[model samples]
Target: MKLNKAFTLIFLSFYSFSKLLAQTDETYLFPINPGNKNYLAGTMGELRSSHFHAGIDIKTGGQEGLPVYATKRGYISRIKVSTSGYGNALYMLHPDGNTSVYAHLREFSDEIAKYVRAAQYENKTYEIELFPDPYEFAFQRGDVIAKSGNTGGSTGPHLHFEIRDEQQRVLNPLHYGFDEIKDNIAPIAQRLAVRPININSRVENRFDRKDYYLSRYGVNYAINDTITAFGKIGIELLGHDKLDGAANQNGISTIEVFVNDEKYHSQIIDVMSFSLMRDIIVHYPYDIKVNKGRTYHNLYVDNGNRLNFYESKANNGYLNIEADSTYHIEIKMYDPYGNISTVTLNIKGKAPAKQIKERIDFELDRISYQVEKNILKVFTRENCEEDANKELSIYINDSIKTVLPAYFLNNVAVYLWDLHEGIPTSVLSCNKGVNISINARAIPHQATVINAENFIVNFPQSALYDTIYVSTAYEVRTQDSLEVFSIEPVTVPLKSSFYVSASPQFSHYQKDKTHVYQTDDAGNFSFVGGSWSGETIQFNHRSMGEFTLVTDDTPPVIRPATEKNYYYISDNLSGIASYTASLNGEWIMMRYEPKLRLVWIEWPEGMQNKRGNFELKVKDNAGNETIYTTKL
Candidate 1:
């Protein structure tokens, strides 16, 4: 058995060594200064509004035509120019199969720029995609290829640099030995909070309870007092980390916590999917009033939620402060390059106390909404849903308000509420089948248009004349002609003083009961079927107007070198293929199975991808195409 184990270990070590050797050889040998600029607008693996930033933003300082160079030996495999997204983008394929992308470019190298300009003039359009043969434009390391500028969706002048695999998956550039960046400053601990969410119904500190607070006594962070609770409790914190030499404070790259020397929770702000951005809400503490944004990097794993990011076991981030006499809590934060900072906290256990003087109500001190005093006197608002079913107490200036009954709507509740001096009054449960209306028009507020139908409405001063009301679920009904309502525009000039009503645009969405149509900016009302010329029309979801059909049976041409024989999984590979499909005016989802070299498609749930002999087009990343036709 010992001999077998020894042999197995030897084999694994050899494989691991080989992999490391390959990675080192693939590293960039020389620095390619994105430009001769020191300013940066963004960095690799930064937390962003919707997604984790994939690349580094090299600052252009609002200037244009600064030269960009190839980081390694690579060929120009793909070029795309568009009004949005990348504006003018170039893809370079490297020998290691990685692709480097430069986006928001003002112009390409002279040779490529001329080619693109010619194509643009010929097509009479700004958008164009080109795939030149491999011999067209190959560059050695440190060769200039493009110049940085503001284009597409960029708000200012900067260059977006990305390293991606052949599958188009972005790889963290910092992990590949991009040695220019450095980070050593520790993260700041802003607030430490605790909640007995599911423990005892009443979450008040007894004589034996412990409270945690943030204190700045040590070099980084330390806790002076201990916390002890009898039952179940959860912890939340607000904090941010700093990178050396950067003005901005960014999210901590990783956080791990230890309770009683046992691993509890771990969280890392690294790569993420575009589709799960909305799940951020569930991961963070949702403040009832202000929506105070938490980092959304929850270290504690919740039941049944399959978020695949943690690398630790035994919940290295959540602490269970039980009846032990004393417990030690340690928190460690790490930057992207693995520099670590830690804080140690001590917690002691105690028994529950019986009766004691009631502390200040946490709800009154925590929840807040900004409103004018005069607004509550005249204007009232209806709460279509129970403002609080979590049994949270409502109070103003330390006085306890009346508690109201709960009414459910489709499992939700309908209640009446009033806001005075930025605080909501005790909820008022209403009877079924009754609609309570409140007039908000009397409130001094302004409104501005948003999109085509919605608007931003802002309340300036409180007014009693405006009222809000609550209504039962049955009060709503279907209609053949839906009258859409939006908050009237407030005649105010300042952007800060304007707001819009909730649900600003309404349409009769019931397919069998109502008809609602909308016209675009061009005054063309589009039906599911096609464009219609009318000031008014009954919108039908099922009926796509009408169309003519043409048939062609010629199969799309598929290329070999760029399509059939291409292999390599690097961030820089750009090869493409194209084809065309025709139908009787329908919608479809295109699927390409590379292994089978076949294309399969399905219509959108309620729509079809069809046009009378429409062009069935397919294109690859490198701009290759194969156009074929199926006859009707």
Candidate 2:
């Protein structure tokens, strides 16, 4: 069975490699800048917040409504209109077993726009996904299909384009021949980090990671400072790439590391599967990215990172250093167009230190903690002989307590506890206790629960991308009887949504008007409709952050803006849920942009002059309703 499994794996690997080779040979024009008149804003396989950028972003001169063209002759397969994420997008199926996507469109072409508008009226919703017949909207190659816009989650005016296979695996658009996009600039290796993998391992005589600056020599670079390393170590680099005629930096395609002339590690991000996109959290150092805002690609494979974009030898590129031994390292960063930048380093391994002396300085009011992978690390000041035997009292919510001994570190006694067992609400030691801290340790592919006095969090078995310490607390209650709940470490991404069941502490006078909402940093409330089962209210939350229960007594505001062509409809809380507009008691087609809080009518060709008793009714998420009636 083992041999057969290995054979299957090898065959699949070869088939995938051959499929990629064939994909590159296929031809597609650039979606924007067909004549090479513009530069790209993003590259395929770039690391983006929450997920990998599935495609390329074509710059539109920082303006919207630019004509976007079809790269190849294909038929419309899908169309999506929404208030978020790829607003007004189109998908086409070509003859080459590939699907082309154009997103953030200002408007579709004449015929396509008409079809989409009709669909919206038929469904009576601004957000809709529709599938058209295979040849319903076929067009020739290089034909103008839509106009680009800075809609949805886009920060600026650009067209987000993508090429994917029938299986939905995203392919690099740069692979296809596109003379429009040019790149000759090599990637820049900004900084290098060497990490000690084991307790006894040290880099520069410290158990923590040490970062080095790079000295440039032409297109190549080198680390000028002499480095000392001991025991097992892993490497990471912070680097970026640039294209010709553009100074904006994006993701690099590949990085190859060699130890003394032998290939040890290679990371290539040519293709990424959407099913495994969230694995990005494990691809880089999660703690560093969240706390330091720096993305450093690991030169070594990490735990639970199943991204099929790496190749390495011997323990996934972790170099085990011995006392008095010397090692040479070479790192090469490559762009998709074959431009390369190199960096070199030399390390001398010194004898490992035993019983190292260090001063301790810190308050034990709150235990300092950093969760690296699944291990729960707590830092505390180390004092006298009794401090060496101090153990952390893990206070589980169910009254069970587990004590873990103090581990090693120079200035602090680090308590390294494996969180696979469970998570604790608080950890206590010597007279000091961490309150309302790590609620429970959530492991990927396993269900976990965090029970508290005010609420209980239920994590689905597939809730996590990687093992993380789930933190939750009832931050505070407002005067309006609103309870703000913090379920945090908002930086980590989840594979599945978690369920929150909470008991209400505030007055329930307006029980029927109450619902949960996710609050952003800007104080905007996104209604996450929840249901109450007696005393406990339950809701599904997609992301980790602040959640609150709001009683929205105020109805949606609907006021005339432009006589009859437009209306300003907004809700103070628990945002607008449903709306309807009528001309003389007859339904009319109305278009809306939620982000702008504007609603208007695109009157049918002949209905502009005929207007009577105009009425518009809008409702908020908590069932509050408002109506505006006027005559034209």
lDDT of 2 by residue, 1-632 (tens): 45687677667755654555455444687888687666888897677756788888888888999888888876788999876789889998776778899998989999998888788777766678999855678787789999999767777889999999989789988888777888889999999999987656778765668888999998999998768989889998998989987777788888999988899999888888998887777677766787689888889987667788899988887898888888889999999888999999998998755345654344543356766545566776655456665777776667756555443446466665666666666677665666546766777789988886699998999787767777777856454445788887876767679998988787654778989888876677888988989887999976788888877899989877865478999988788888888889878777777777888876654687886888888998899999988886
- Quote model 2's TM-score: 0.83
By lDDT, who's the top model here? 2
* lDDT of candidate 1 over 453-536, digit per residue (tens): 222223334211122121111111133222332222111111112222323123422222222232232333331211212322
Q: Which runs of model 2 end up more than 4 angstroms from their true locations?
A: 1-26, 196-202, 209-211, 229-233, 347-373, 376-441, 469-492, 518-528, 559-564
The ten-residue window of minimal lDDT in model 1 covers 468-477
Off by over 4 Å in 1: 1-26, 29-39, 82-86, 118-124, 127-135, 195-213, 217-219, 229-234, 270-290, 293-296, 302-306, 315-326, 346-632
Local distance difference test values of all predictions, in order: 0.48, 0.80
> What is the Å distance of residue 400 in model 1 from its true position?
25
